[model samples]
Target: MDKFVTRAKKRVGGQSKKDECQRENLQKKPRSEVLKEEFQEDEEVNQFPQPVPWQKIEAEGLDCDYSLLFSKKEADTFFTQLEEEVVYFTGDQTKVQVYGKTYSVPRKQATYGDEGLMYSFSGVHLSARPWTATLEIIRDAVTKATGHTFNFVLINRYKDGHDHMGEHRDDERELDPSCPIASVSLGAARDFVFRHKDARSGQNRRQIDPVKLELAHGSLLLMNSPTNTYWYHSLPTRKKIKSPRINLTFRRIVKQRQRNAIKPS
Candidate 1:
């Protein structure tokens, strides 16, 4: 036991000396040189494709910033990687309750984020899995392009045109209202529609026209503030599209403690 303790002490002492040497070397460099080296190191690790010019679409209560984040070759590679890496919910977990009626979702879905983060809507709760390698790379690229940080990502895979998303607002209580949701699309072009809250069927419905957009492969859409507050968006079905589509919606979720603090007693 004494021999073991002595060996362990020597090992720790050696490691400490090595760390001190590294610190001394770093301190010897000029401040500007040290900073430049650190910056270069960060760049080496954070290399990502540059984002193209973005176009803004504005309306009475909607604001969308669209850009093609990846070229055709890059998008094709990402699409294949995502299809192999993401594992979607199956069977009963894929069903959601709407108006007290349960129905299987048309598209497959998955969630990834920081541990313990969760998102709930349509009477369904989705617990986040740990971020995968491909997802982290994609998330980093989105953040680089949008300058917005996200802790959670919800993935939806549409097998073909028959798969669709119904109109709904993402103003869930757990979502951060101050942050914009960044949506990245891979594979297949589809139409995205946004309807005003007052335009939906009802006695007080207005004549506001729904807004439409064509989301192409490798596109990024930033839905900024006030949009979710008054508009509902959906990917309606088109019978002719045969290719698959994968969408990653990166979001900033309020931490659990913050949500609890804001809740009513």
Candidate 2:
């Protein structure tokens, strides 16, 4: 009995020594390092900033979904990378026509997509540039989150509050009405306003109020169908904002040959 007790005590001592050695090794690491290791382990168990939920923004003739697609840390990383890598149109190519007159777009813009894709708006035609590594990564994430595929993207860079988008409908002939446009915003937060098509015509047979949404950094706004069919949206100028904002509107553009069969908007 004594021998068995002695063996048990030895086993206990050995385990205690092993535990003490492990504590000493941990102590050898800097406190910050130790804490970071602990936090990392916890992070593996429980991811930080759990997936953000999508919010519905519905109104008369409006259907949209809004959500912060990425955490602030993720968004900051993307914004910095995009600012360095995105190439914008320059010179006369940047000019757009409105009301029979041409004016330089207030913001820098670029388009990237599959081969042979073209987007025309405000009398400006933009042929798609090949997708960049950063843009592909963004597109994959957006597709995974939204469950929608896009063949084209229009990247508009607002170089401060002065750069704004005029009120317009995205019901262009090349767009596929069956697909929703995923608009991803990075950097400065800005208000996106929407007005009903009939209201804009000064014929208010039905009292429809305008819809407004604040597009935040790393945010995603899905403009679903029928919403674009009845409403127009714009990012008006906010002169007080000095920081830059980048918006990527992902779309599935029907090839030119298929456009003839598309329904009119």
Candidate 3:
């Protein structure tokens, strides 16, 4: 026991000496100077200019509907349940590809992937699952607010501030151009930025006129005809915020196969 104690003491003493040497080296440098260097390095890396936060400046004629999209308690319960049942995939999550490169999907619960199938990040396609009772309740509320029928919904869960969806236009060939797209946000608030594709030829040239919207819990944002046609939206990352958020985009898809099959018959 004495020999063991002596060996332990010597080991502790050696570790203390190594720590002291490291502390001395660090203390020799000024903290403010080190921080300044880090700040400069960060600024150099992020060169793109960010947009201003969207604000409701004037409420003159805007028919912005403010209603309880879902009960706070119900929303909380649904999120908790979803966190458990949904299978999460990360950037390192592997999948076998049948046609092309197998891209990694984000870390979140998605019920659309095939059994033992791989997913991609670039085109993270999710099929519209059959609406649950909870989802139907919310969907009915949204339909009442927007005055439009939404046949399908694409849900996205951002587990943290780092989990982000890239900039993409939802103007796919499957969707109807005339119908409006309604998005309901729940959980943590996030910024939804929208930028124009043809800024140079149109009014805002060399300028990204982004509508940085703060999607609060149970808030609904309806994008009508012109909005989808003219702008591209993205949910950007903010390292300061650490909470999760869920966004459900309700859409009306016009099946091309159905259209083609009935034409010649």
Candidate 4:
């Protein structure tokens, strides 16, 4: 019986010493590693930001949503690829008609889409160039992210804040009523503003502040439904902003069906 008790006591003491050694080793480990192991499930879990509610502009009855479609690394990759791979044209000194008077537009722009798609705006008609590899990648990602397919993209290059676009509704005849426009911005941030068309009327004298957004890099601004019909959006000039900005507005172009009817030239 004494032999049995001695053996049991030794076993218990050995286990206690082993457990103490393990506890000391654990204490020697970095706190983060210990915590991570303790909360293994939490460490393995991925957390993402919840979608913010759509911002409604009461002045113009426009709904807008902003989302971070790309992370910083993804955005940097895109910016580098765009800068090195894509050939962007500056629409410098491009004459455009405004209120029946011709003037040069302030920035450079281009249109790219599926073959033969034509887009026109701001007294300019841009013929779609075949999509490049980089553009196709971006378009596919956008389609996947937004769950909406687009056949065309309008690329606007603002060399600096001085390269501004005027306030105008995108209610062009060719735009489909239900299609949503997703605008992706990369590089230096810029201010995008919208104002109610009614506020500009001569009879309406009340001051209405324009709703504005500071479009950030890798961010997406989605405009849909009645936004284009009720509000005019613009990128006003800011002389202090020296960095360049690239904006890609993805759009769906309704295809014009070919008719086989004979015509006289």
Best TM-score among the predictions, by candidate number: 1
lDDT of 2 by residue, 1-265 (tens): 0010011012333457777797799879654344334433543322333344889999887999999887777677678768877889998779987889989888999999999888887767788999876677678667867778999999999989999999988988889889999999999999999998888765455667999999999899999988998999999999999999999999999896334534454
Candidate 2 residue pairs that clash = none
TM-score of 1: 0.80
- After superposition on all C-alphas, the RMSD of every candidate to the true structure, in Å, is 12.3, 12.6, 19.6, 15.7
Please write out the lDDT profile of model 3 over residues 21-120, one tens digit for every residue: 8668657855433333333345332232222122332121121223344456546655664554444444433232334776443435443221222222
- Model 1 CA lDDT for position 100: 86
Candidate closest to the true structure, highest lDDT: 1
lDDT of 4 by residue, 1-265 (tens): 0010001012333457767797798789754344334333342221222342334434447887787666666666567666654555545426676888888777777788888777765556677888765566567656655678988898888889899989888776666667789899998899999988777778765576779999988888889878888788999999999998889999887754111111223
Q: In candidate 1, what are the lDDT values of residues 1-265, reduced to their tens digit?
A: 0010011012333457777797799789644344334434564435554554889999999999999887786677678868877889987779998888999999999999999898887767788999876777678778888888999999999999999999999888888888999999999999999999999989999999999999999899999999999999999999999999999999999886335634342
Which of candidates 1 and 4 reaches a greater TM-score? Answer: 1
Better of 2 and 4 by TM-score: 2
**RMSD (CA, angstroms), candidate 4:** 15.7
- Kindly report which residue stretches of model 4 are placed more than 4 angstroms away from their true locations once superposed: 1-60, 89-93, 257-265
- Number of clashing pairs, model 1? 0
Among all windows of 10 consecutive residues in model 1, the one with the lowest summed lDDT is 1-10
- Backbone clashes in model 4: 1
